[model samples]
Target: MNLRIFGWSYAVTAASLVVALLYGGWEALILCAVLGILEVSLSFDNAVVNATVLERMSEFWQKIFLTIGILIAVFGMRLVFPLLIVGITADLNPVEAVTLALERRPEDDPTSYAYLLNEAYPQIAAFGGMFLLMLFLDWVFTEREHTWLSWVERPLARIGQLNRISVVIAIVALVLLATFLADEPTVVLIAGSLGLITYLAVNGLGDFFEQAGQKQLEAFEEEDAAGPRNGSGPSQLAKATGKAGFFLFLYLEVLDAAFSFDGVIGAFAITTDPIIIALGLGLIGAMFVRSLTVFLVRKGTLADYVYLEHGAHWAIGALAAILLVGIGYHVNEVVTGLVGVAFILSALASSILRNRRLAAQGVETRKTADELAADHTSV
Candidate 1:
């Protein structure tokens, strides 16, 4: 781990802390630093998922994700999205929502932005939880030659052989939670249905475009094998331009938004200062997560740690369950963060052990081959 890979991000974080101190004094600065660290801890799995998608993209698109995509993650999701939620949920205009957010600090009053947001928590949890559950289910159901947790994943995959099993499980889980576990069944039902719909729409759109891109690439490959047909065919150019990457990028952004939903709401529990939340979480989003994605891609960490993605999706599944359960009962964010970290670290340890076994087996095979060669020479 070359710490210098994150030198720029650390510099930016330091600069942001200085600004926080200037704006809100020592207490504000301390809170902001804590929130920043919290964001990084909560979203480590997010970096793993982002790296998986990003490794397939071209260099230009990768740069676009780091530069333009960071803006969307920081400002779009962290700042404006919450306002949009408040505006819609509270029936206030955007400015009114902004006022509501800024008017009540955590210390000032109970009926502040935090309170209103908590009021909207049932629906928020439903939407985010269901969406994440679908992602996890989809991954588990898909057939793979390689698996990390074979005992758990293999059984799930076997059951998942049924057509549309992921959708079925999501709907069933939503219904059970809404009917039996949720405080507001109607809200959970509506929000969860919409969440499922949104996942289908977004995921289906990405798949459709990706299939088209794949076909285009196949056609271009055929044309290339036969020698260039024309100057540069449109299909050839389309494949080169990474239409699939564009759709995957869109999917990744939506996924990131879903992941951030809990973090945004949870931040209020720490501090209800909208300014502090924005500055702290925004810096983490901009500096840390983005850099981690790029760093993982460059270093090929996923290839080395084979089980990392599996662990991430498992952690995501756990988070989704916790969020849904929290609709009726409160679950601490610290618990959620700890669970995610445990899965990731456990997978890392397993991967290291497996690599050692494979290395020893390889050495043994080479030794046997060398002995066989020696025996043949003597004969």
Candidate 2:
């Protein structure tokens, strides 16, 4: 793992910490630091999943993801998103919302920006929860070559063979949530439905383009085997490009937005100051995910650690459940972080075991990863 990719992230983290200390006091700095740590625990799974999608993208789009994606994560989701939400929920215009966000601190007043954002938490939770749920459910249903927790995963995959199974389960979950858990059931229904629709549209198109990209690669590989054409080869055609790359990029952004919902809302629990939230949750968190994504792609972490993706998707499923449940009840950030980390660490441990098992069995395909997994042990 080259540390070079994180150069920009470190620069941003240091710059933000300096800004936090200068802008507020030690209190703000402390809160900012805490949020940064929390965001890593909260979003580490996000980096894993992002790497899975990102590896399918072309180099050009991958560059765009690291550059433009960070800007959107910081400025768009972390900053403007809160302001925009406050504006819509509070019935304040854009300027008024910005003024209120900047001027007012977190007070006991019902009119404060934080108060308004908290009030609208359910809608945000509903939308983001359903979107992430769809992502998790889609993976859950798909029959895969590899799996973790095979006892549970194997059963789910068997049942998932039913057509439209994931969608059915998701809709049923929505109906139950709206019926039993919501204060305003209609709002939950609409928001949740929109989330489901967005997932279908985005994920569906991304898969379509991915298949197309695969076909293109196959064709290029065939041409290369026969004779070289232009300067293209398997390496050049390896990634998804054109429309395929575009949709993959879009899917990643939406996925990041969904992941940030809980973090954004939870940050208010730490500090009502938008600037601190932006600096901590937005800047630092974005840096971690971005750098991790690049690292995973470069190092082939997913291939080496077979169960990491499974662990990440499981964490995502758990998070989706937490968000939906949070609609009516308080969900602790500690619980959320612990759940994600547990899955990730457990999956990592399982991957090591599986690598050893395969190595002991003398599986030819497992040669490379097994070597990386346990270098001391002879094959």
Candidate 3:
């Protein structure tokens, strides 16, 4: 319980509540709190995934994520994004739509926006399903090498520079969906395309930065070998570190947005009040995520549970698939939770069994050594 982190989180949560209350009064406050809690609990896996990215970032960037990044997540996605969705789906002007969301009478049915968004399920399903499929492919391909299924990925690997091609194909598919499939598809298309493209673009940028980082490391090492080693100049070191941190932060934010997609949509299942949704899901939920990140970092949870990262990645993949299913099929939030829990449990059990076997082998080795010593003594 680092008081500083706790204090900051408390302050932010209170501030958000106060703002919501000022705008919408007591009902809004209550809804925001509920949404926040729901968002936090549902997003437990989000913190784990974020930690993977956060750990790689510099301290300054990590602070920025906790500070600035949280605001973007809370306001931009949780608050604005849904209203934007409503505006598109209902053919209303964006400002008018937002005003409607903000000023709708308390007694008025809150499900109006939810109903509109629900109508666009097909597009959501297509985007989410394809995204999940890509994740599964990456996982299966990556793990095959570890499990002696290297043969499977070999052919795929031969299609050199596939990522760029994949991006082009995804763009094409989105165009077709927007052109033909959607009723009022532009908004959905724009949102989905932006999400996908951002993922690809950020990943590409990170890879580029990584390569640049390696080059810099090599140059420094060579320089060191040639002369009496001088400590790295502060400015040069800072630049390199800043570049790495920025890349990592960007990567983390993209992943965070992906994790929040389902949670944001699912919040609709609970309530259509944007302010309540933001307060409940964004402020409370995101604070908990930040806290969870700190907890994981402090406990070194990722290092302890070797397969937990695998489980999280798998969970994310499943969620992505579920999102796609929303296009033509209805998906329950409970089903999403159960499926993720099942995969995680299976992965955890496997890890435990593997560790147990190793422990048993160690015990057998010790017993054998003891027996050999007894025999030598008798001799």
Candidate 4:
């Protein structure tokens, strides 16, 4: 991987370190670096999934995703999002919440922002877990000719033929999680249901708009006879228009938020310092993720490693289960990160092996054709 591809991420790192040093000397800077690394480690799967959605968008929208979307990921989800959680859970105003975060230290202050955020973990876990569960279910159930985990995925795909099965599975998972695995069942139920609903809304909107766009494109094709205009570019944005573009952007942001949920909460484990968490995880970490997404899209890594997406969703499924389990217990962040990495690496290896097999088959087929042609020529 060329370091130049991640130039923006490098800049973010330098800036974050400077801010950390200004905020709290060497100690803060070190902590910031650690948290930033942690976020990147934990969110590799997120980058893969983001790239998958991002590559489908047009060049203009891709720029928007890198710029505007980064701001939302870094500041909106990373910083303000935690505060919103604290404010709502603790019944404090925005100013008060900010004060609570700044003034209180997790080590000494029982009423610190970190503590409040931890207290609200049940709901956070419920919502994030359910949302991720739905994503995982959808990926598994959606029929595909190519599969990474053929044995498991094939069965799931078969079951997915039943209408709304993904939703049904998610609902059942939420209920089971709430009834047996959550500390506060009512809160879990409510949050998990909201997560499910949010996923459905975002996904449904994207599908509806995509269908509309397809119809429009079809009509345009019919009228023109030369085919839908490719314009001056060959990008997903060029292919998208109006509602489709808007909905795709919305879908990406919502998906980013859902993915960020765990990272935000997980940051608390490293340090309860809101500033450090935001600078490290939100700014530097998220910037790297966005950069990684762009890198993957530009390099066509997804096309090369077809099974990588499959591995990512499997990792997501594991993470979802871990989140639900975390509602009643503290799961180590390192373990969580490792599980995701393991799945991703495994998928990559599988893709390589499959490629080798296909290449071998092609070579053998060519050799057989050559022998047949030689025999015919000799006769």
Candidate 5:
């Protein structure tokens, strides 16, 4: 085995084990192992999909993803995010809320939070319904063009300037629904607002960082051009374009979160032990994601698997809809799995058909070429 890969894996796994050991002892350790396995299994498709985006990122960005990305995944999502949700929804003090989650005994009923949220079924349905509608529209509008279902890109391409405004409007609409329709309007508003704010804040920061990265790339390219004699070098401007590439990297992580929403919620259905959830799902899932990233980088899998990215985006879109449902309506884990599995299976089938068609076309071209060559030789 490659020691470097081994070292990286061991480090993450060991850190998880140590954390579990410190917090809850042998039971925690068992929980960590089981969760890790569950995460790995559930997220294989996630890893494959993430690798599609990660492969397009720069080496420095890739390093940042492994280091900083893991921190965000753990602390931001696993530790703090859920607590933040509970605080806003339950009106519990943030620290106290988190402590409740961390220290709540398994023997005692832990269904209060889950039940509180589940009661708002109509609101959940509205959120999920609208979200699902948007997803369907996006797929129909964007994908129809690719499939040649229509001669032109429809209303989406034509409605150019209102795009950002439309997103803002959607946010406002969600805010209205959460505030007016939810049982605890303030809690719902806070929770919904946090998500929107988090998205915008992270997106804005990522944009700024990416811009700075572009400037650095330009400077580096200029230095390289001036210092070394090389043929057909990529220009400073081209290098600068890589700044945008970094934004794409950030987009992938955001996309990953969107994809994980249902899985995270579903994990709650299994067990609500925060530490156990973190150990079982977060760390282990992250390990597999890291491994998938390395595998994609090493094997150039993204280049080889043409339609895999398409499949992943479809999965992301589906998960986004499911999350909207989770906001108000209860989604079963079985349904989540079935939906994801169905989309993946369909994508795989499409890929096989596409590959076979291409192969047939290639064979036909080769046959024609051979016939022409034989005629020329006879002449």
Candidate 6:
């Protein structure tokens, strides 16, 4: 509740809105504000997932995530990525893509540049949807002592005992999505497969480095125990560093990209002006999300609210479902966003009730350092 962390986000929002007004006139300003709300409704759970991973990083890397990572999230995903997609899909060079985007508006004409850009939606949905599905599957399948939606999650976790079941389920879902409903079935299948591969590579690499860091921590601890000991153990020891930190950082970017896939496409419905979209969604919405993520980490919110992370993954799962379904049909953006919000809010309410019940019973629920720390000799 300090509110100080969001100072930079507020400044950027003002500046971005001012640019929207001056360049785009009052209508642009209005759309900018509208897009901010849209982006938030679409991506707040993205921030929560980010916090779970980012809280483990060193302070220096955390700064890198905010600075360099913001640039990637804003410009890389919001701007360059769209352009890149158009270029590849339309077989246009980069300059031609930029020229087309500058010349034509989709809101007005059927054969406009924006039309070409919008045509790439199915591929985008496939890639982002599969990636997120993998993330949700892995999390739910991994057995954990604590769970928020036990009836649902516990059953999924039990199924996880079958090795690589998450991958199997994801593949089945992808096949169903592509073969049954998608217009460009082959293209969506390839895109979704790439998404699955990307998730496996990044998650596998991050986990490997995380285990190495944990081993290093364990070595330090054993050394500490052999010699003179402080009453406290090495509580401050880093769970992830060096390569582990880099891979985790990479994972965060992929997660952001996946989360933004639909949000970026959804912005087209409001305006085809890429600049305004970046300013509204990237500069304003994403900036606030990053700040909120840091706030959650610094405040120890996740540790206190045990169900929050579970809620986020559940929201992610819902978002993935929406994206996959959207390939065959147009799903309302509000519906997509609200499904995520509902899951998160319900999870938060459950966490509060659980906390109160534990307090009355003289029981505790805060995650032990080890529980939160797994992934390194576990963060």
Clash tally, candidates in order: 0, 0, 10, 3, 2, 4
Best by TM-score: 6
Local accuracy of candidate 6 as per-residue lDDT tens digits, 119-223: 888888999999999998888887776888898888987998898998899999999989998998999999999999999998889878777877868877787
Candidate scoring better on TM-score of 3 and 5: 3
The digit string of per-residue lDDT tens for model 5 on 1-379 reads 4556546666778888889888789877877777676565556567665564465457777777777887787666656666665676677887777667766545234445443333433333343334433433333333221231123334543552344543555466566766654666665555555555545544455556556655766666787878963443455444554654566566556645554555555665656677778776777667666776677557654444444444554554565555554555566766666666666666656666766787888732112323322221200
The parts of candidate 3 lying over 4 Å away from their true place are 1-34, 88-94, 105-111, 120-136, 143-194, 228-237, 360-379
Per-prediction TM-score to the true structure, in the order listed? 0.91, 0.90, 0.74, 0.90, 0.65, 0.93
Name the weakest run of 10 consecutive residues (lDDT summed) in model 3: 370-379
- Could you tell me the TM-score of candidate 6? 0.93
**TM-score for predicted model 4 compared with the true structure:** 0.90
- Residues 287-330, candidate 2: write the lDDT tens digits: 98899889988888788788888899999999999999988887
Ranking by lDDT: 6, 2, 4, 1, 3, 5
lDDT of 3 by residue, 82-186 (tens): 777678777889887877776544423444666666665555555554554444444443322122123443554345236545456556656665566556566
Local distance difference test scores for all models: 0.79, 0.85, 0.64, 0.81, 0.56, 0.85
- The best-first sequence of candidates by TM-score reads 6, 1, 2, 4, 3, 5
Global local distance difference test of model 3: 0.64
How well does candidate 2 match the true structure, expressed as C-alpha RMSD? 5.0
To one decimal, what is the Cα RMSD in angstroms of model 3 from the true structure?
A: 9.4
Cα-lDDT of candidate 6: 0.85
Which digits, one per residue and each the tens of the lDDT, describe model 4 over residues 1-379? 6788898789889999999999999999999999998888888999998887776566777888888988988899999999999999999999999998888575445688888888898998888888888888887887764677898889988998899898887888888878887878999999989988888887777667666666666766675686556554334433546555566778778777877777888888778888999999998899999888988888877777778878888988998888888888888888888999999999999888887887888732112323322221200
How far is each candidate from the true structure, as Cα RMSD in Å?
Answer: 7.5, 5.0, 9.4, 7.8, 9.5, 3.6
Q: After superposition, how far is residue 176 of candidate 4 from its true place, in Å?
A: 1.6
Positional deviation of residue 74's Cα in model 3 after best superposition, in angstroms:
1.4
Residue 282 lDDT (model 5): 75
